[model samples]
Target chain A: MWRKLLTRNEFYVALVVVGLCLVIGAVNPVFFTVGNLFDLVRNSVVMGIFSLGVLIVIISGGIDISFAAVAAFAMFVTAKILVPFHFQGTILVPFALSALIGTLLGLINAVLISQFRLPTMIVTLGTMSAFRGFMLAFIGAMEITNLPPAMIAFSRSFLVTIKQGRFTYGLHVSILILIVLAVLVWFILNKTMLGRGIYALGGDRSAAERAGFNIRRIQLFIYCFVGFLAGIGGIVHSALVRTARPFDLVGTEMSVIAAVVLGGARITGGKGSVVGTMLGVVLVVIMNTSLILLGVSSFWQRAVLGLLIIIGTGIPAYQATRRRRAA
Target chain B: MKQIAWRAILPKDTNVRWLLVITVLVFVSMSLLRPTMFFTLDNFSSMAFQFPEFGLLAMAIMLTLLSGGIDLSIVGVANLSGILAALVLTRLLPAEASALQVVLYSLLALATSLVTGLTCGLINGLLIAVVGITPILATLGTMELFTGIAIVITKGAAVFGFPELITFMGNGSLWIFPVPFLIFVVAAAVFAIILNKTAFGAKLQLLGTNPVAARFSGLNNTKLLLQTYMLSGFLAALSGIVVLARTNSAKADYGSSYTLQAVLIAVLGGVNPAGGFGRVGGLVLAILTLQFLSSGFSMLRFSNFFKEFIWGAVLLVVMVINYLTNTRRERREALLQAKECEVNAQAD
Candidate 1:
C-alpha cells in the first residue's frame, strides 16, 4: 500500500507542494501565516476550477482551449445582461446565466467534434478565436467596472478573516465554491458509469464503442460539463476581481493547461485525478504568487515558468521513450 | 512537354485549383467593388510590403502542419529574432557610422536574426523530436520560454534604432516591386521546389502519413523531424528580419495574434492538420486570397475586430467544406472498390 502511494503521481505532487511550502516558509516566515494561506487559497480558486474542467476533457481524449473564451464571454455577457436591468439580486442568477451561456458555447464545440468529426484542437481553436472576436466586434469590448451589487458584495464576503498590521486577508467565499465543485467532480469521475465510459473512451475509442458506451453522448456531456465549469470559474473570477474585461481570461490558457498537464494528466489522454489536479493548481498558483517573494523579477518569472513546463513535460516523456527503447 | 512542365509547376490537387479560383474571385470582386482604392498600384505596393512578414510566418507554420506537428512558438521566435537583431544593430553599429559600416552591420544583424531563429528551432526540435514530447505541447512550452526570454532581455520594452540598410530592406522598392515581396517570392519559389523535388520533402510526407511505416522502412524519423523544425525556425527568422525592418522596432508582444492567424492560414491553404499532405502553391494562393480580403475589408472601412471575426468564420467554414469534400471522395472511392470486387466475384 505504501509503495503504491509512493508511485502515484498525486503523491509526488503533494510531496513537491509540501517541499515548496517549506522552502518558501524558511525564506519568509510570513508564508506560514494564516493570512498568506488565505491569500494562497483565494488565488487558487479560479485556477483550481479551470484545471478541474480541463482535466475532465483531457481524460476523455480531447482538449478544449475554448473554455477561456467561454468563460470570458459567459461572464461578460452575464454582466451586460444584469447591468441593464439593475438586478442586484443574489449571485445565483448571475452564475446560472453565465453557466447557461457557456453550455451553449460548449454545445457548439461538442456538435462540431462528435457529430461532424472535426479534430478537437482545431475545432476549439476556431471557436476560441470566433467567440472572442464575436464578443469584441458585435457585443462590447469595454471592461465593466460597475458590477452588480451582489457580485461586489460576494467579492468582499469571506469565510475566514485574518487581521495583521493594517492588512486584512480573508479566505474568500469563492474557495468554498471551488471545494464543492472539486468534490462534485471527484464523485462524478470516481463513482459513476459516465466516469468509466469517459476513461474507456480516452483509453481506446473503438474499444469504448465496442463495450457499449455511447461515445457521442459522452463527448457531449464532457464538453458541456467543461463549459459549465468554465462559466462558474469566469463568474468567480469577476466576482473576485470586481470587473469583467473581455480579454481577461484568454491568455491564461497556457498556465492552466500547464497546471493540468503537470498534475500527471497525460496530454495523449485517459489518465488524471481531481486530487492530483488540485495539487497541480496549488503548485502553479504558488509559483505565480510566490516568485515575487522569492525575489525573482516579474519578467524572469515567465522564463522560469516556461522552463518549468519544458522540464516537467520533458522528463516524463524522456523516461517513456527510454522505456520503449529498452523494450 | 509543356503540359508536363505546367503540371510540375502547378500542383495537381483540386484544393489548389479551388484556392486559385477563390484568390481570383476575391481579387476581381475587390477590384470591382472599390476600383479606386483596391486596384491602384500604390495600394498594391503597400500591401506587397505588408503581407510578406505574415506570409513568411504562415509558410513556416505550414511546414510544421505538413509534417504532422505545430510550432506555436514561431511568433515567439520571430519576435525574439527581431529583438536580438535590433539589439545588435543598436549596440554594435555606431550612430555616426559611414554607409560601409552600416551595410556591414546590417548584414551582421541579419545573421543574428537567422542564428537566433535557428537556435530557437533547435530547442523545439530537440524537445519534440528527441525528447518525444507532442509537437503542440512542446512548442507551447517554448513559446512561453522564448517570449519570456525576449521580455527579460528587453525588460518588456521594444528595441529600436536599426541601420538605413536594414530599414531599406523593409521599405525599399526595386524596379516597381517591394523588396519584401521580392524576398517572399524568392523564398516561396525555393520552398515550392523543395517540396516538389526533394527527397527530404517526400520523406517528411511519408513520416507524417505513417511514422511507424517510415521507421520500419529505414527512414530516420528523428532526423527528418529535426530538419523540418529547423527549417520552420529558419523561415520564422526570415519573417522576424522583415518585421524588424518594416516596423523599425522589436518587442516581445508584437504580432502575437499572428500565431493563430498563421495556423489559420496554413489550414486555409489546404494543409491537413492531421498531416501527410500540403502544397506550397495552394498555401501561397491562400495567403494572397486572405491578403486581398483583408485589404478589401480595410478599404471598405471595416474595423480590425470585424476582420478577426471574418477570419475565424472563414476558417470554420473552410474546415466544414473540406470535411464534406473528403467524405464524398472517400465514399466514391469505396463505391468504385465495391463495384470492382463484385465484378471479380462474378468472373470467378
Candidate 2:
C-alpha cells in the first residue's frame, strides 16, 4: 500500500506543497497566522475557480486558453448590461446571467471543435482574441466602478472573519462558492457517466468512439461546462474585486495552466484529480503572493514560480521513467 | 479543360492557393475603397517597415509548429533578447561616442541579443527534448522564466538610449524598399531554402510527422528537436533586434499580444498546428495579406479592436473552409481507390 501511494504523482505534489508551506512558515511565522490563512483562502477563490475549469479541459485531452477571455467577456458584458437597468437584486441574478453568457460563448467553441474538427488550441486562440476584442470594442473598455449594489455588498460579505489587532481579515463569501464548485466538479469528474466518457475520450479518441461514446456530445458538454464555470469565476472575480474591467483575467491563462499541470494533471490528458488541483492552486497562490514574506522581491516571484513549475513537473517525470525502467 | 487551366495557374498546394485568393481579394478591395491612400507606394513602404518584426515572430512560431511543437516563449525570448541588447547598448556605449563606436557597439548589441535568444532556446530545448516535458508546458515555463529575467533586469521598465545607426536601420529606406523589409526578404529566402533543400528540414519534418518512426529509423530525434528549437530562438532573437531598432526601445512587456497573433498568422499561413507541414511562401503571403488588411482598416478609421474581431472571424472562416476542402479531397481519394480495387477484382 505504501509503495503504491509512493508512486502516485499526487503524493509527490502534495508533499511539495506541504514542504513549501513549512519553509515559508519557518521563514516567517506570521505566515502561520489566522489572518494570513484567511487572506490566502480569499486569494485562492478566483484562481481556484479558474483552475477547476482548466483541469476539466486538460483531462479531456485539450487545452482552452480562451477561458480568461471568456470570463472577461462574460463579466464585463454582464456588468455593462446591468449598468443601464439599475436592477439592484440578489447576487444570484448577475451570477446566473454571467453564466448564461458564458455558456453561449462556450457553445461556439464546442460547435467549432466538435462539428468542424478544428484543433482545440487554435480554435481557442482565435476565440480568445475575438471575445476580448468584442468586449473591448462593442461592449466597452471602461472599468465599471459603479457595479450593482448586490455585487458591492457581496464583496463585503464574509463566511468567516478574523480580527488581528487593528486589522480584520475576513474570508470572503467567494471561498464558499469555490468550495461548492470544487466539490461539484469533483463529483462530476468522478461519479458521472459523462466523466467516464471524458476520460475515455482523452485516453484515446478512436477507442472511445469505438466504445460507443458520443464524442461530439461529450465535447459539447465539456466546453459548455467550462464556459459556465468561467462565467461563475468571472462574476465572482468582479464581486470580490468590487469592479469589472474589460482587460481583467486576460493574462492569467499561463499561471492557471501551470497550476493545473503542477497538480498531477497530465497535459497529454486522461489523468487528474480535484484534490490535487486544489493543492496545486495553493502552491501557486503562495508562490505568487507570499514570497514577500520570504524576502523575495515581486519581480523575482515569477522566476521562482517558473522554476518551481519546471522542477515540480521534472521530478514526477523522472520518477515515472525510473519506475518504467525497473518494471 | 477549364479546371486544368485553373490548376495550372494556381499553386499545387491548396493552402497557397487559398492564401493567394485572400491576398488578391484584400488588396483589390482595399485599393478600390481608398484609391489614393491604399494604392500609394508610401503606404506600402510604411507597412513593409511595420510587418517585419511581426513576420519574424510568425516565422519563429511556424518553425516550431513544423516540428509538432509550439513556442509560447517566442514573445518572451524576443523581449528578453531586445532588453539584453538594449542594455548592452545603453551601458557600454559612452556618452558622445564616435559614429564608428556607435556602429560597432550596435553590432555587439545585436550579437548579445542573438546569444541570449540561443541560450533561451537551449533551455527550452533541454526541458522539452531531454526532460520529456510537453512543448507547451516547457515553453510556457521558459516564457515566464525568460520574461521574469527580463523584468528583473529592467525592473519592469523600458530600456532606451539606442544610438542613431540602429534607429536608422529600423526607420531608414534603401532605394524604394525599407531596410527592415529587405532583412525580412533575406530571412524568408534563407528559411525557404533551408526548409525545401536541406537534410535538416527533411529530418525535422519526418520527426514531426512521427517521433516514434523517426526514432526507429535511427534519426537523432533529440538533436533535430534541439536544432529546431534553437533555430526558432534564433529567428525570435532576430525579430527582437528588429523591434529594438524600429521602436528605439525595449521593454519586458512589449508585444505581449504578438504571441497569439503569431500563432494566428502561422496557422493561417497553412502551417498545421499538429505538425509536419508549412511553407515560407504561404507564411509571407499570410503576413502581407494581414498587413494590408490592417493598414486598410486603420485608413478606414476603424478601431483597433475591430481588427482583432475581424482577424478572429477570418481565422475561423478559413479553418471551416479548409476543413471542408480537406474532407472533400479525402473522400474523393477514397472513392478513387475503391473504384480501382473494384476494377482489379473484375479482372481477377
Candidate 3:
C-alpha cells in the first residue's frame, strides 16, 4: 500500500506537504492559527504566479533564468509610466502596461529561440542581463513610493473572510488571483490541443515534427505565456507591497525554479502539472514561515530550502533509476 | 577548381577561422575606440590579469559541456573554496611565515579547494549519471546546495587579510605579465592536452557525441561521468583560489555571476549545448574576445548599465551566428548525402 501510494505523484506531494504542515503545527500551535495561515497564503500568491510562469517553460522542456529580471523590468516600466502620467489612481492602466511589456519581452525570447534556432538557456541567460540593465537604466535606482491609496486598499482588501469571536481569517486579493490563474492554467494544460502539442514537442522534437506539429509556433506560444504570467506576477507583487522597487526580485528565479522542480516537474520536460506546482509553492511558503516561527537561524533557512530542492528532485531521480534497473 | 570551391564554400574547420576573425575584429574595434589606451602594455597587463579568473571558469564550463553535461555548481564551488582559503590564510596562518611557507600554504589552499570541488562534482555526477536526474536539474540542485552551505558557514560575511604571497599571486606582475596570467597559461596548456591527447579525452568526446552508443560499446559511462565532473570541480576550486588571491577579499557571493557567464562563454566559443563538437583553441579565443570587449567598455568610461547591455548584445549576436553556421553546415551535409543516395539508386 505504501509503495502504491508513493507511485502516484500528486499523492506523494500532498502527503509530504500535509505531513510537514502537521509536524510544524505540532511544534508550534501558532502556525495553525487562522491569522497566520492567511498571511502565509497571501505572501505566497505573487511567488506562486512567477513559479507558474516558470512551470510553462519547464513543461515545454526549456528553462528561463530571466523571469526575475523580466519581473523587475515590468515593475519598473509600470512605475515609470504610471507615475509620470499621474495615472496611479487607475490601477488597471499600470497593471495592463506591465503585462504588455512582459508579453513583448516574452515574444522576443520566443523569436530568438524558435526563429533563430538558438538554445533556450543561452538566449534567456543573455536576456536576463539585458533586461536587468534596461531596468537599471530606466529607473536610476529610484523607488516609487507614492502609490494611490485606492490602489493600496484594493491590493490589501480581503476577498474572503471567516470570523470567530476575537479571531478572524481571510483570503487576500492576491490569493484569489492565484487561484483563478491556477484554475485557468489547469484547464488549458489538461484540456487543450495546444497543451498536448507542447507535451509532444518537449517529449521528442523530431518525433513531434514528424507527427505534423508546428514546433516553432508551439515554442513561441510557450515563451509568451511564461512572459505574460511573469508580468501579472510583477504587478501583483508591487501592488501588494504598495511600492515598486526595481531590485525587489533579485535572485527570485532560483526560488521559483526550486519550488516548481520540487513539486515533481522534470527539468527535461514532458512531465508537470499546475496542481503539483501549486502544492510545491505551498510547501516552500510553509517551510519559510515555519522556519521563522520556530526561530531557526535565518542562515539555516536557505540551507534547508536548498536541501529540500535536492531531496525533492532526488526522489524521482532515484525512482527513475530503480525503474530502469528493473526493466 | 574543386579546391577553390572548397576554400570558398566549405573553408575546412570554419569554426576555428571564424573565432579568430571575431577576436581580431574585437581587438581592432577596441583600438579604434580607445586609440591610446587599447594598445598600451599597462592596460593589456591589467586586462590580462582580470581575465584569467573568468578564464578558469570558462575552462570548467568547457570540460562539463564536453562530457555531455553542465555544472551550475561551479560558481558556488568557487565561492566556497575562495572564502575558505581567505578565512584560513587570515585567521589560521602565522604572521611571521617565510615567503616559501606562504607559497606552500597557498598551494595547500588550492588543494583543499580542488577537494571541495571534487566532492560537489561527485554528488552532482552521482545524481545525474547514476540516479538518472537530468544534467541541468541535478546541477541546479547542487548549485543551491553548495551556495547555501557557503552562506551558512560564513553567515553572509566577507573574509580578507591573506598573506602577501597569496595576494601577490593575484596582483603581482612577473616582468610584463601578471602572475595570474602565467598561471592561466599553464592551466590552459595542461587542460588542452588532457582534453585532446588522452584516452580519457576521446572517451569524453564519444560520451558527448552519443551516450547510449558509447555505453553499448562497453564504455564505463558512470566512471567517465564522475571524472568529468571532478575535473570541472577541481578547476572551479582553482579559480576560487585565484579569485581570492586577486581581490584580497573573499565574499560568499564571489563567483555568482559566473554561473551564466561561463555558459555564455562556452556557447559563444562554439561548444554545442547538445554536445560533442568544440575545441580549446576556439574557447580560448572566445574568452579573450569577451574579456577585451568588457574591459574596453570600462576603459571607454561606459556606465555599468551600458557595459551590461553591450555584454548581453554581443553574447546574443555571437550565439545566433554560431547556431546559424552549424545549422547551415548540417543542411549542406544532409543534401550531399541525399545526392549520394540518389546516384547509387540510379546506378542500381
What would the per-residue lDDT of candidate 1 be over residues B147-247, giving only the tens digit for each residue? Answer: 99999999999898777688888999999999999999999999988887999989988888888999999999898998889899999999999999988
TM-score for each predicted model, relative to the true structure:
0.96, 0.97, 0.93
Instruction: Flag regions of model 1 displaced more than 4 Å.
Output: B1-11
Q: DockQ of each candidate's interface versus the true one?
A: 0.71, 0.72, 0.63
Worst 10 residues of 1 chain B by lDDT: B9-18
- Give the CAPRI rating of model 1: medium
Better of 1 and 2 by TM-score: 2
Highest-DockQ candidate: 2
Model 3, docking class: medium
Best by TM-score: 2
Which prediction has more favorable lDDT, 1 or 2? Answer: 2
* lDDT tens readout by residue for model 3, A135-230: 786456677887655558767688788897977777787787888888888887889988888888778889889999899999898888888888
Residue pairs of candidate 3 with colliding backbone atoms: none
| Candidate 2 residue-pair clash tally | 0
For candidate 3 chain A, the 10 contiguous residues with the lowest summed lDDT are A84-93
lDDT of 2: 0.91
TM-score of chain B of 1: 0.95
